[model samples]
Target: MKGYYQGFLIRDWQECDRNNAANILHSVLTEYGLPWLPTGADKDVIKVEEFYLATGGEFWVVEKQGKVVGTAAYYPVKRGEKAVEIRKMYLLPEARGQGLGKYLLTELEKTIENKGFREIWIETASVLKEAVKLYESSGYQAASGVETPRCDRIYVKYLPLE
Candidate 1:
């Protein structure tokens, strides 16, 4: 899954993309007042293959002019019937306000649904107002049980299986 979207190359995680992906995630997390815990919630950022692809999930990196600028990923979970949790969705400041976040989210939902995932979960902090807004506006309803130490809100959306 790779292509140019609005001049940005969106592609699956590659071995060479490890460092850049981690950096972008860390930068955005810190910018939003969240700690960069490589040994905790963010551990997957450094081991994309083992944490995502190897587990029937996916991680993507967005690049612009040869510079990595964003990431989006999701993995299977047991909280619901055929469910997956969206994680590691981040974008550099400069790459924001251009609909890339919305685009990535729409793309993720479509892919997840196509892959037979019936429900999607998301955990986020209130400080990330944009994310909260995006989730709500996209039909994700407020939920509970935020397992991440830094996240305070949870949202879940169920896809209609065709």
Candidate 2:
């Protein structure tokens, strides 16, 4: 499944390929009232590099016709354990409703499983109804509830590693 769609490539992030992905994330998050306009510190390209090189975290970009359409990242949550967190999953408006979210998530699960991760967690705002639906549709049961200083609702999921 290297290139599932025409000109679509889901592969590791590269340093030079930052602004587009970051812009997509910023745009998506802005819809939820979460402003993350990338400053110098939040350079998507550099963030990807650091996360991959320093923490062994995995970053994936979905490109179609040589243009980025979606992005997702996975990072270790507990040291010496098979727990990880899925973060920054976003897709462009034009790319929604085509089962891309589910596809990206399924790919992420496969990656995590291969990395020995048994459980995956995600956090999202309650107001984002689409995200909530996506999580629930993907078999992510609510493990716990959380209220953060900057966030309203948080949900977690545990995947069986059979």
Candidate 3:
């Protein structure tokens, strides 16, 4: 959960990284004209430990030059048998178009599969075109029942059982 990817350190979230991670999520949402919805869609960003770590999930922060620039997390969900939902995957504007997003996602999938999760779900808005493309190209199939209020598309990738 801790390594360097293209000069950015990807590691597990810590108590000290709360504000920086939240700001990265908020900034990315705002850049895409999306609502923050702290009480709804983003409630977990403020309580990563309770919602993710405590629930047998993981939350990670990407740091460059000692500053948090991106966030990625996932939590076990009841949507499907042995499933998890990828959440809070966002990056600051300056951090986009650098292959970091794809790298983070690949790492996430590897970790999730290694942890015995068979299905990985993602819910995202169409406004985030880059994200939609990334998911589509990465073998995620379109699905329904997006639970997030701000999300309009849902995708699911089934990993081969080990």
Candidate 4:
């Protein structure tokens, strides 16, 4: 599938046998963040790997040209309840402005709704204006007065499974 931008592909993190997961994380921390860091952040990478391995959460990679250009994760917030948290959503710098983020989000919402989740919640830093816009346009509403130490905005959208 090299050089092809077919609809975003979703697969298990472990299924990414080419170490794209690590590349995805490094890209997010370096290319997308404030400052690029040296490739010696082994501890951070291990921590994320451990979480991915231990949780019931699922990680998905978005590929274009056979390269993992984006990633996202979803995990249950409460057992036996239709609630989940969307986290660690990242896309490579070269992959932005192509509506791939929105595509991933739409896929996630549909998947959650199909799985009986009544609502989907996400938290994003206030500085990420594009993300805020994506969420808002996708029917997510700003959560009033809700605050988290790591993020300035929290949004929620209800999925009606009729």
What overall lDDT, based on C-alpha atoms, would model 3 receive against the true structure? Answer: 0.92
Residues 36-118 of candidate 4: C-alpha lDDT, one tens digit per residue:
23243223233455554465556677776667777777766652247777876778778889877887787777777777778
Clashes of each: 0, 0, 0, 1
Instruction: Evaluate model 4: give its lDDT.
Output: 0.66
**What stretches of model 4 exceed 4 Å from their correct place?**
1-8, 15-19, 29-55, 79-81, 144-148
Model 2 has an lDDT value of: 0.72
Compared with the true structure, the alpha-carbon lDDT of candidate 1 equals: 0.93
lDDT of each: 0.93, 0.72, 0.92, 0.66
**lDDT score, candidate 2, position 36:** 69
TM-score of each: 0.97, 0.83, 0.98, 0.73
Off by over 4 Å in 2: 37-46, 79-81, 145-150
lDDT of 2 by residue, 21-67 (tens): 78877777787787564554235334776665478787878888878
Worst 10 residues of 3 by lDDT: 18-27
Better candidate number, 2 or 4, judged by TM-score: 2
Give candidate 3 misplaced runs (Cα > 4 Å): none
